[model samples]
Target: MSSLRQALSGAGAVLLAVHPTLAQTAETSAPTNASAPPPLLWFLISMLVLVLLVFWLILVALLAWMRPQLRQIYDLPTVHDTWSGRVLGLLVGDARLVKGEVRDELLDHDYDGIHEFDNDLPPWWKYGFVLTAIFAGCYLTYYHVLQNGQLQGAEYAAEMQQAALMVSTTSDDPNQLTTYTALTAPAELSSGKSLFATNCAPCHGANAEGKVGPNLTDEFWLHGGEVNHVYKTIKFGVNGKGMVAWKGKLSGKQILQVSSYILSLQGTKPANAKPPQGEKEAPAKTLAAR
Candidate 1:
């Protein structure tokens, strides 16, 4: 223990001697004064705040000045002109307090045989009926003489012409080169399947087994069986046939993909096909075969 104490004393003296050198270094190197933050930072923040405050003040003043103008534009009534129900509940009453637009449909309920047609609809309410009648007159004038095609088959013919113009699939030889585009990718097939689920599944089953529309998987086709022919049948429906035109319901690309999928169903027959109604058979495409 005496030897350890002697060693500690020697270490303490060494440390004590080093402490003066450290103190001198600290005295020489320690910052006497720190630099103030850049005035530009404070200046930018102060300017931003001042600009915001000025903008706020300007906005408040603009709103205050425009208040009367806004009120005039909206036709807000002055205090004197504003409605305050009838004096002494006589000529002017709570019944009159009802808005000018608010009309009551008073049923024929009379107490003690005293019938009263007390207050009819306000002028504003009556004007709505008048406006409706006036519009009806204009409607008749515009539709009957000016554009009578809406009814009586003229409009129907015009509409058909418009549709025929839209389908631009023309041919050099009607016998060959059917204009329908074929869908080959899995992406196209998936999209067609989704579309069939949404549109045709309710009619035709999801797998094209017969439901409301005919089975597409069967070799037998009501209209025709080829991809292009199927596209045609889909685009412009067979006349007097349960199958309606799907041109508007499905886009051209969607129709092509669906037709391609249906063609892929060729040579495979489902359990039920409606006895092949149409005489036409699709031109064979070996590529479309499974």
Candidate 2:
């Protein structure tokens, strides 16, 4: 009893001595664990491995469960007699299965001892031919029988009529001169500036100093110097020259705005301006005075 008590007392003393050290170690490590974030890469890798393992197990179980069905399919006769087998064969275009029974009976016609078997067309081919016939019937009904859709000639004529209407609205006669003065409104000029920057900048330069097109700042005109003349030139661009006709693209009011903006740029000579190409014409002082 006395030895047992001594052993118990010794164990208690050891535990009491180690308790403070263990608590101190745990306290020191707790802050480090709380401060540091867990690594994400290892966690992601482990999760991917777990998912793959689960997928493989599922695949193996499915294959095991379907073993009997796979064996039955493998052992199926080449020429199926059942209705389900015939339907499957039809879908897959299996000759022997779709035909059901072999037609060994030769045709009555024989030439030089060579006989031909009267074999029917494949099921898939027959079905496809029927589908095409149905489509043709529908097409005939829609286009010819009821006349619901327009023919190519009629459609072309309709498009031409719309184009003629557009042309009639804007007079293209070269002799018909406009008396429109240069627009002095700030709003009109701002809209024209934006239009010029988008459409004309590539050829005429950002400041209309001219690159591929003529300089607008100089007192020289390719078509005409007057605002009305400029409007005509812009509306019906030079045919042989690089200028594209803006009649179909821009409205009459838009063309006038752009022409007015071009006139406003006169006498503001920009750097690296191109040499004058057309005849030197005096600026339209009367139009600018408006």
Q: What's the lDDT for all of these models?
A: 0.66, 0.81
Model 1's alpha-carbon lDDT is 0.66
Regions more than 4 Å wrong, model 2: 1-170, 285-290
Q: For candidate 1, what's the RMSD?
A: 17.5
User: What are the per-residue Cα lDDT tens digits for candidate 1 across 154-257?
Assistant: 77888877876676656422223355556768898888777777877787776777777776775566656657777777777767867778877888788887
Tell me each candidate's TM-score.
0.36, 0.40
The predictions' CA RMSDs to the true structure, in order, are 17.5, 17.6
Candidate 1 lDDT for residue 212: 71
Worst 10 residues of 1 by lDDT: 85-94
Best by TM-score: 2
| Clash pairs, model 1 backbone | 86-92, 203-212
**Candidate 1: regions farther than 4 A off:** 1-178, 280-283, 287-290
